[model samples]
Target: MTVGSTPPKTLYQALFNKRMLICICTGFSSGLPLYLLIQFIPAWLRSFDVDLSTIGLINLVLFPYTWKFIWSPLVDRFVPPFLGRRRGWMLITQLGLLLAIASLALYDPTTNLTKIIWTVAIIAFLSATQDIVIDAARREILPDDELGAGNGFYAQAYRIASFVPGSLGLILVGFYPWSVAHLSIAAFMLVGIVTTLLMSESSKPSEVPHTLKSAVIDPFKEFFDRDGWQSAVWILLFIIFYKLGDSMATALETPFFLDMGFSTVEVGTVAKISKTIGATVGTILGGVVMIKLGINKSLWIFGVFQIVSILGYVALSIVGYNYLMLAVASGFEYFGVGLGSVALIAFMAKSTSRLFTATQFALLSSLAAVPRTFISAGTGYIIEAVGYTQFFLICFACAIPGMLMLFKIAPWNSQKTAVEETIAE
Candidate 1:
């Protein structure tokens, strides 16, 4: 099937398939550890009276996520003794994450800060590695036409998994010892391991990279050679800039809420509700819409929603401390994020060669993470300098460059047949 062409499956048929089931598992497994690091851990540290600076520095451990592509070739080149290549790595990384997360229960942040940091770092590494194999596996298993819906399901499940660590884990900590909460969360890795065991390995590439050097070098070479350097550069730049504004706008969302005089309970309750409902609805709806609109058009339309969502924050900044507005703005922002993320992921999946799936997807996704990991770090300074209203305006402006680049990278009328033709060469 051509990349741009939709399959004739009904919405029910599209969503009910085994492939979408796997997408759900892939997303939940991939999201859990990352959220554990970003959401649960910070709260854990603060509960123990760890200094804000130390807690902030802990974010640096997530550098593994942005550099996972560097080691992705290792995953691509080496198959484990069992479960074939993709499933083998998925199982290994999930197991490692399980053990590492449970190990956090053994150390007190007050007394064993260094050990805790190192353990979290190891978890981050394992989580990032898991993402590489899972992404490649998803790409291999889904048909070209299913990329939009498949990734939409994945995005929804990813957001749902955040609730485990972000909400459930925190609630557990209140009623139980930190150890129990840690172990409870760790036990959730069993879901991933079970999914790995149940899933057959995705179809193997016709030509697997024979050596580490080839694995590392050839994926980059293949991507650049596919459409020449100019197109490749445009795609990379779009990946970086597409979500840059939204990411920066929400960099310190909890602080922003607090600054607006919302209590912790109000912020947590409202955000969890809004994010769950909004992101869930957005992804599922986006998936169904992409069936008709195609990824190219979805990008253009959803890109507009992304820009408008930032303006919602801008409105909130001006209105200040209104609960209804907070809920509306937060929900709308997550909805936009969901739509944009699903479309972007489908585009990235479509861009990769199956032979280089792991490495290429890793590189593309790492570039997407750059805005969140690095550029968002400066948001605090920007907000301090210009205030929230102005900062959001700047974020709104940052989103436009990416949308403009879409005219070249993913034009509204462009057909994926051209991309398929390039890969066929």
Candidate 2:
């Protein structure tokens, strides 16, 4: 089939396939520990009276996410003794995450702040490593045509996984000791373990990267050689800035709700529920829309939605303390996040060579994560300096450069040359 022609499968058939189911499992596994770091841990710190600046500084621990590309070559080059390359790494990291998450219960944030930070850092490292394997595996299994719906389902499952540490963990802490809550959340890693055991390894590339040096050097060499240095630089910049605005806006999300005088229950039940519903509907809708519109147009349209959604946070800042407004704002913002993230992920997956899937996707995604880790660390300072209303406006402004770059890298009328080439092959 040509790239210009409609896919033979219906949406239902596309979504119900084994590949999509695997996407769901891998997505859930990939998302859980990260949310536990970004959502649950921050809330835990705040509850123990950790100041905003300190809590914000904790985002620095997530530096591993931004740097995971450095070690991705190891994952790409070496297979563990048990499962094949991808699933082997997945099993190892998932197991490490389970242990690291549960270890968070061993310290009190007040007295053992150093210990907590180190443990959270370890979780972030494991989570980042796990994401490398999962992204490569998903890319290998999904064909070019299926990238949109496949990544949509993956992104959906990713957002759904947030409900565990983001929403349910918050509520659980209300009834149980922090230790019990931490352990309970840790148990969820079993889902990934089971999925890893049952799922077949994705088809390997015909030619593997024979040495660690080749794994490290060749992905970069191929990407630059393929696009030329100038276009490749533009693509990397877009990867960094595309989601910058929304990412900064939500950097201290749990803390933002608390600062706005919402109780943990209110944040957990109302705000999270609304956000999850909006994200779920938006991702599913975005996936379907991509099937019709193609990824380039979807990026243009969804980029607008993402930019506009930051205004909801500004509105909440203006109104203050109203549950209806909170729900509306949170839901709207994440709905846009869902739309933008789905397209971006599909774009990243499309950008990689299957032979260098793990290393290339890791480099692309790690660049994508730079804002969330480095720039977001300053958000607490920004919030204190400018207050919520202006901070969000700045965030809204941060998104504009990325949209403009789309003109260069992902122009609205551009052909899907990469996917067409893959189809020809």
Best candidate according to TM-score: 2
**Superposing all C-alpha atoms, what RMSD in Å does each candidate have to the true structure?**
3.8, 3.1
lDDT of all predictions, in order shown? 0.82, 0.88
lDDT of 1 by residue, 1-425 (tens): 99999659887887789999999988999999987887678677766866444565566677788899999998888889898998888999999999999999999988999999899889989999999999888888888767776877788888899887766776676568889889999999998999999998894655557887798898899899988998788788889998888877765665676668775456657766887788888888887797789878888999999889988888889999998999999899989998898888878877888777788899999898887667765666677778889989999999999899888767778765245546766
* Candidate 1 wrongly placed segments (more than 4 Å): 1-13, 45-57, 106-113, 173-180, 203-208, 258-265, 317-322, 384-387, 413-425
User: Which whole-number lDDT from 0 to 100 does residue 173 have in model 1?
Assistant: 68
Candidate 1 TM-score, C-alpha based: 0.87
Query: The CA-based lDDT of model 1 is what?
Result: 0.82
In the range 1-425, model 2's lDDT, one tens digit per residue, is 88799758876876789999999988998889988988889899999999888988899999989999899998888888887888888999999999999988899988999999999899999999999889888888887777777777788888999999988888888788889889989999999999999999884644457787798998889877775687678778898999999999999988888889998888889999999999998888888898799878989999999999999999999998999999999999999999999888888877787667788889999999998999899999899999999999999999999999888767678766343343345
Residue 184 accuracy (lDDT) in model 2 = 87
Instruction: Flag regions of model 2 displaced more than 4 Å.
Output: 1-13, 203-207, 416-425
10 residues in a row with least lDDT, candidate 2? 416-425
